[model samples]
Target: MELNLPESRSRSIRCIVKLGGAAITCKNELEKIHDENLEIVACQLRQAMMEGSVPSKVIGMDWSKRPGSSEISCDVDDLGDQDSSEFSKFVVVHGAGSFGHFQASRSGVHKGGLEKPIVKAGFVATRISVTNLNLEIVRALAREGIPTISMSPFSCGWSTSKRDVASADLSTVAKTIDSGFVPVLHGDAVLDNILGCTILSGDVIIRHLADHLKPEYVVFLTDVLGVYDRPPSEPDAVLLKEIAVGEDGSWKVVNPVLKHTNKKVETSVAAHDTTGGMETKISEAAMIAKLGIDVYIVKAATTHSQRALNGELRDNVPVDWLGTIIKYSK
Candidate 1:
């Protein structure tokens, strides 16, 4: 796939965050949500996003830099000012977890067998399940006083060809940022030109948006502490604290030389997931890093994730922080 960058923006998007399905939901329980975890995440987001929740017409570049800034609308673009956002505007994407995974997996929806009656039924069921989850997420964020607009890929004009991104117009997403409203999108059942329909994962969505929007950084909030040397729970499993990606998208663990290539670097995928799981998440993170964007994968609701979300995870991270950082090789 080509790295097609979007038109120049005066002020680039601050950051893109992906909330893992397994991290926020009960994967073992069908359609069950982790309410307490969601509340914790919402409160964390509120402290970051809802602090200066007022709509401002930021007219000039240094408006926010000035103390006691007022609602200023500047017609001039910020020219992709790296510090312009201060994370005032951002995007959020989440996975299906136990929500739509069961129906989609049973119906074989991702394999593009929608011509069958059962497959079609599964497609409908999957969307209904995931969208219900999406609304719940939106309500949680809203309760924190964050203005959130829920967007489904199916309804947002996002389609796929051969299960790859074929048509995805994110103008509305950019417009949503311009309007100071956070856009919350989730994994969805998308129409595929080759197959009648297919599943679009949130990880893929994060990569697609990063390739186009060129955000300051990206964060993945997951269930596990971070990437491991092998499948998690293994006795000898070693956490990969940092990874560096080559220009061609190849990545290597920073300190310990990993003998296994990405092909052999194993990860566990949920049985009900139509889209790939942890493996896909890591793959997407590397691709984003190839674009020179820092990608952080940390456990949700942890102090590490809070710092990452609030733009506090800089080059000089806390010594005790435990997570995987994928960045472009120097």
Candidate 2:
């Protein structure tokens, strides 16, 4: 029953978990903030923190859609009942997925999009949305008794759209761990000075957290299972139990057109979200693992936020323990 984690590893080490909307939200990605499934996830996280298995810092992704946008209208407030048992004990960071995705696709505002000349009006609008999203999570976590802080690339004078150098911000995350407070971050469409408007996903946020803080574990609970050799829908596709993220970035390309593969991961393999594709997740993992952090890709169905926090989804395998470990790896 004792987890053979290293003695050097702090029992209170901060854990940076990236939650995908597909898994946390109800069908069609509806914002059911008070749904039973979410409560279960929160309970699992709280239990893990209470047990000292992971640090008290638990962050969630809340995509911030544009103001007056339909996606943002889904649900904004509601952490848990004020008197609920799982009121506090963690930090939550929700991305503006509803807003970012739309803006990125429609306005062509991403690190790539910003490469071209853009008007100041457009830049201001994007920044506002990004700031508002970060603030919303901060407010919610504060109300829940878990003091949290917002760390955005923009606040750092970095573009929200592209992957710029973030060593200083990473250090800030380390400080969060040292101080016993949780820091929440999300994938943002930042204003890249070089790339203009760049899009960063929640996975990228976790990657930055892992590389900087070097947490004991990084759990990404997406809509599907772990990684597969081929698409999971195919009958012959095999689930990879464990993979040492290839440094060559070979896993970066699953298909010619699709930069990342589109399959759910099993309990013991590297999982990929087809939308952003597998390449993105693989690259991020490669970077995190280099710092000696372990990343697990779990399907939201089996391991909501809470289940993952309790280590129920961690594979028992005793390898160096880096990159996408599922239950079967043991």
Candidate 3:
């Protein structure tokens, strides 16, 4: 039940990369995988592994020891000795976009409690759909020659009545990483102590793993490039290249001076999503950032998407990075 990783493994940089459901699946279509995008990300992961280098750059106060710069710097010194024979250990968690969202929404899975008898069918349907998608993802990663092991959160994680993660058995996840296999997990319908069942988001899974694994980086690959001053759909919207987390774990826009007329920032979530969309992702990343781990939110469809997941910042700077950098600030 213990991770019991070797001292060498403990010193290696550990990363958790999340592929958002929206990034991999067409939310409007039923169980459709974005094959082209998935292939891009998979190839990137394989390339990173083959090269045996950290892909993305780490930014913010936690990493730089200094702040206020337009871009954060990477601390290569902390990246432990690079071994050509082995790749950095990573844990991947993906969302259930078109696969589970439609069914979960219909089943009231996000309601945080038991559902009516008729709604039970929705719950069953949601699980089947999500599992099917998991298989597809695993197949794709395998095709790219990435050693992947699919793990179901339902089998290992539990949540409270309020739907917060109560406990999860991550020993297997840790073991898989130690064995050099990427553990693939997804959002799932799980048994809740107070509620008969509820939806457990992949974002929540990342948070829990971060607490346990203390990964050096947590990257979220989504449909958008990164957090924007306004929704990306807005013409005036500018990407918030970097965000700082307050001492109390609140989010602070690092570059709030962008010229955008919209005072209110809106986040886009797919119509079928039962989980809070961009809002929940940002909030969770901020909390993780407060723990001194740098979090990157980037678009998975970009050429740089896979690089971001590997912890590689495009220009070795946060501003130039393709995604939003969330880090802790004083």
Best by TM-score: 1
Model 3: per-residue lDDT, tens digit, 1-330?
Answer: 223333444445468889999999887888899999898888776766665544353211123223567775555465466332466787889999889888898878666455687457777888898989998888788666577888988866545456887667776677678887888999998877777788899999898889778988888989988888767888976887788899887776776565544445576767777888888898899989988898989898676566676567623664455678898888
Total backbone collisions, model 2: 38
In angstroms, the error of model 1 at 132 is 0.4
- TM for candidate 1 is 0.84
TM-score of 3: 0.83
Give candidate 2's TM-score: 0.62
lDDT minimum window of 10 residues, candidate 2: 266-275
Report the number of clashing residue pairs per model.
9, 38, 8
How far does residue 36 in candidate 3 sit from its true spot (Å)? Answer: 0.6
* 1-330 per-residue lDDT for model 2 (tens digits): 111222242334546666554445443332233244344544454455555444334433334566677765322354353232232223344444333444444455553554355533444555566566566545444443344578765554434423553323444554554455666676565555556556566666666555545566667765556566666677865555455545443333221234345543422222222126555565676677666666676664343444555555444643332224521111
User: Which runs of model 2 end up more than 4 angstroms from their true locations?
Assistant: 1-12, 25-37, 52-96, 111-146, 160-162, 166-168, 233-237, 246-275, 301-307, 312-330
Q: What is the lDDT for 137 in model 1?
A: 88
TM-score of each: 0.84, 0.62, 0.83
Segments of candidate 1 deviating more than 4 angstroms: 1-10, 50-87, 256-263
- The sequence of per-residue lDDT tens digits that candidate 1 reaches over residues 113-172 is 778999999999999999999988887776655667898888888888888888886877
Angstrom error of the Cα, residue 213, model 1: value is 1.5
